[model samples]
Target: MSTIADVARLASVAKATASRALSGKGYVSEETRERVVSAARTIGYVVSPNAASLVTGRTKSVGVIIPYISRWFFAEVLESIEQALLEQGYDMTLYNLPSASPERDRVFEYFLARKRFDGVISVGVELSDDEVDHLHRLRRPLVGIGGAIRGVHTIAIDDVATARLATEHLLSLGHRDILHIGGNQDEQMDFAVHSKRLSGFLAAMHAADLPTNDAFYACELTVPGGYEMGRSVLGDPRRRPTAIFAASDEIAIGLIVAARELGILVPSELSVIGIDGHPYAEMFRLTTLEQHPRRQGRLAVMSLLANLDIPTPEDASESTVLATNLVMRSSTSAPRAPLHHA
Candidate 1:
């Protein structure tokens, strides 16, 4: 097969010069680098990653740990991360496992302890102090998505503020009787996202001087879950809320489906709002807060790659909080009649 020696011979450059040109470690003239690249392509010569790692101490790969692959937000983040890594000529190793599980313990204790990657990007997986310390000891740069982690670089949105904004939007529309449909607080995802969102909703309600008793309903954080809850909650005319703030776009879409099934006109009979800029949101014309999970994923990769240059424990401790924007749509409006207690 073709080798760097062959490429160097074809380019009429010394083997050491060709090696420097291909590795990009030591400086080579721009023209010489291009000539070596052309010669390698002509000879179908490829650099051995193992050999390169032996020389540079870099695997040219990144390890990604995430909790869910089927969920929309996590899926989007994973896709973005993979794409960004590919563009940067880096390989990605994905660990799709549940949080707080025995398998997770093994991966962290055994698999990651080996340090086969140059860096790590954790999406929605809250690493413990010990785990963070382990990676630091290995001198592997770590970056997290979904929430802040002590002593780890992280990129996340302010869940509390985002949820509060969603609730406040409904309240501004004169919705005194508003119900929040979201993930179960008792069964929270990593970083207690469900609880934080619920807290935000309550904070907004209390600020508006509205009674919050029985105002929040727990669900599975999916469309089917929202449909089931909507059927029961909207079935009773006396107890029906004038507006609903869904924790996700899927739930909002499900609630709208249930409302239609019950012969209730949207925005006129009841208003609905949700988080997430899910692709279906535009189809349903749902009002929502666009959190942009893909953006977070891309940012996490960028942050990790930037730190890979320095690879210092101090540089790995930075935190970045992203912003969510409100998207106005046809799903929400002021109540058709004067607001009254349900």
Candidate 2:
């Protein structure tokens, strides 16, 4: 019912001037801009993003590529990123990227090549060199979370150091028979986070002159996966560990549940520590290293928005590694007795 032409006529300015004022693109006097804006409000006129982008070369939207949406860490990251973008007057388009499949290929070859959004924020998906080059070809800003990417700004925590700290905490409490329960090294997730964490645990164990034989147990990175593994591992009295360093909070919670079911008193019979500050951690009184995923998400959005208009050098990629905080709880303590092998 209303148009820019009508607003310009009512405000006594040229149509181009009205457009520039509304879009905030070209220089327009404050008095003229206020007059045009008042006229637009009076006429119920709204600027069309499609038309505005034609002149400003910005969609005011960001594309997010993530591997999983249901997982706790990923879900938190996505929510924080969406909120941060909205606060900056930007929209979000989410792409749920699946593991190596035909659909995944199409997402890279077709969907991404379209350049529908102003930039991309990749979460927990390590893009290959070809994929990075493809996005670079469009000259759009790119940011990543969960791990580093070549030629891209990334936000992440030091996985190795965090895991080592968790393990060392148990060792400080006189836990010699410790086990690391985490994702499989062979079926590594994006950036080999599973392997990195396991490596840290092993490194800590070795540093203390402790034997690492049969030290790792591979399982899915979820609560249920941990429950099942915990059931079997804790069921065997001969092979039970004095302490466990879970790769995630969910796994640690599951293990605690399983240990309770088997009449094993936590901290008295077994100790457990994990990464992630999952909401349930406090309820379970589990010791953990909180790697604030939501903070990473917000920082990722900040990095992308700040660099959207700047030209980044090809070799100037920077990785911002955040620190993890250690949370002490009732789940970990000194072993009740000396560790004995069956």
Return the number of clashes found in candidate 2: 0
The alpha-carbon lDDT assigned to residue 21 of candidate 2 equals 99
RMSD score of candidate 2 (Å): 2.7
Q: Name every residue pair that clashes in candidate 1.
A: none
TM-score of each: 0.96, 0.93
What TM-score should be assigned to candidate 1? Answer: 0.96
Local distance difference test, candidate 1? 0.91
The list of candidate 1 runs beyond 4 A from truth reads 314-316, 338-342
Query: Model 1 residue 226 lDDT?
Result: 91
lDDT of 1 by residue, 39-103 (tens): 99987899999978987878999999998899999999999999999999999998886667788
TM-score of 2: 0.93
